[model samples]
Target: MHGEQMAEEFPVVGLDTDAREAAELLASQRLPGLIVADENGAPYTVLPASQVVRFLVPSYVQDDPSLARVIDESLADQVADKLAGVSVRALLPKELAELPVVNHDDTVLEIAAIMARLRCPLVAVVKDRKIIGAVSASRLLEVAMTPH
Candidate 1:
């Protein structure tokens, strides 16, 4: 399937969404990520589930895996506490990487390249300055592996 076809299966979120809410949506929907839109509802960025997890964990813990052992398992249940009042934009890299986006008519190959370069599980598909949908890495793989 092409990008627009694949995008129909995914969901979108706004840039102002709370980090904790986004995380919960990712978990509950079993999605790789969500398409983030600007106030105008134009596709802006891709927020991957991995990024959310990285945001929840302290940088020191991420830099040193051994430090994770010091925290009790119960800490996992308190992720919301750590993410309280944090917006999705705050969790994004401060350097401001370009948001990965593809046209609705873009080929699977193009979508794959964007996902690879961005290191994100999904890419936003847009038309007329609005998000049409999202193309997920897994969906691309499924199309690739299917018999032609």
Candidate 2:
């Protein structure tokens, strides 16, 4: 199987997209992550749901997870506020993860390797320098586990 063969249309966000909206999308769709496109519409980076959740947690809690146990439910409900008025770019870590990309004709094994090496849930499949679609980790696993 090839990348395009299994590729599914996936959501793509921009660096300047509202963080709250992005979070809402993730929550509503249960997406593992988003493909963030650059100004030229090429893959810039991935915005994983885990990263957003990490950003929501207060630094103090991250420093000492024990503090999380102390936080009350009321404050927990306001965690989404942290994302208010922020852009996706601001949510990115200081050092970005490698862009998980594959050619349209890349083999399934190739796609799997890129996903495993990057620890990403999605891989953007590009053709002629433009993103056409994406092959998700679950889709790859499905193909791998299924007998031809």
Candidate 3:
């Protein structure tokens, strides 16, 4: 039930990485989320695919190819503009409820309770305030349904 026991290794992407690269990583890995980290590997925020999609297509803008061609015939500028000035930090979902981070010593039930109350699908595990892994809601469900 220890946090380490519940923790599952997840991918970490640098905050400064381009949105295109992040998109590729998520698509290639088939992960719903990736950890956002600083240059020194310090945790900053979590990037979910939902937010990435938002940056790609703004609600107000119609993705019309003809209009895009008129704006920038090459279309490179259009793509670049969608991601310009957008670091991982800026694109992260701000509606995240309390970020449930627990030490490796915490119990599974404790972590599960936090996730349930916060309605978060995952909880980041930390040691010395540095992220080590995550405990997903699915893992907690498995533990709960397993026979003791």
Candidate 4:
């Protein structure tokens, strides 16, 4: 399958979108991640579910899993407060490893390679420098496992 065939339309979020709002969208949509678009609605970067979790959970909790056991219902709200004013861009690492991108006509194998290299959950499919859709890593695996 080609990228265009495998690509699934996902919601795009702006760089300035609040982390909490982005998290809500991901949860409500049951999406693996969301595409971060530039001012021109062009693909810029990806915000994977793992990245979101990392941003939400405190570092101490991540360092010691046992700390998570002490998190009560009330404390959960406090945890969410951390994301109140945080933007999507602020959650991203300063150095980007790669931007998983593929042309609409790219083969599934090609897309898979890019995704693997970048360790991204989704890859943007572009046509004429504009994002047309995206293919999740799960979709790429589905295509790979199918006997074409």
Candidate that scores best on lDDT: 2
Task: Name the better of 2 and 3 by lDDT.
Answer: 2
Measured with C-alpha atoms, the lDDT of residue 88 in candidate 2 is 95
Instruction: Kindly give the number of clashing pairs for every candidate.
Output: 0, 0, 0, 0
Instruction: Compute each candidate's TM-score over C-alphas.
Output: 0.90, 0.96, 0.70, 0.92
Q: Can you tell me which runs of candidate 3 are displaced by over 4 Å? A: 61-85, 94-97
For 1-148, candidate 4 gives per-residue lDDT tens digits of 7898888887889999999999889889889899999888888898888888898888998999898888897987687688888899988878876777799999987998898888888999999998989999888888899996
**Candidate 1 lDDT over residue span 1-148, tens digit each:** 5677777656777877888888888999888888888888887777878888888888989999899888888986786687788888876766756788998888889888888887888888887767877777877898888898
TM-score top scorer: 2
lDDT-sorted candidate list, best first: 2, 4, 1, 3
lDDT of each candidate versus the true structure: 0.81, 0.91, 0.72, 0.87
lDDT of 1 at 8: 65
Model 2 off-target regions past 4 Å? none
Query: What lDDT is reached at residue 147 by model 3?
Result: 91
- In candidate 2 the C-alpha lDDT for residue 131 amounts to 89
Give Cα distance to truth, residue 74, candidate 4, Å.
2.0
- Clashing residue pairs in candidate 3 are none
Query: In terms of TM-score, which candidate is stronger, 1 or 2?
Result: 2
Pairs clashing within candidate 4 = none
Q: Write the per-residue lDDT of candidate 3 for residues 17-125, one digit (tens) a residue.
A: 8777777787897776677777887666567676687767544445554553455445544653676656676676666545557778899788877877866666778
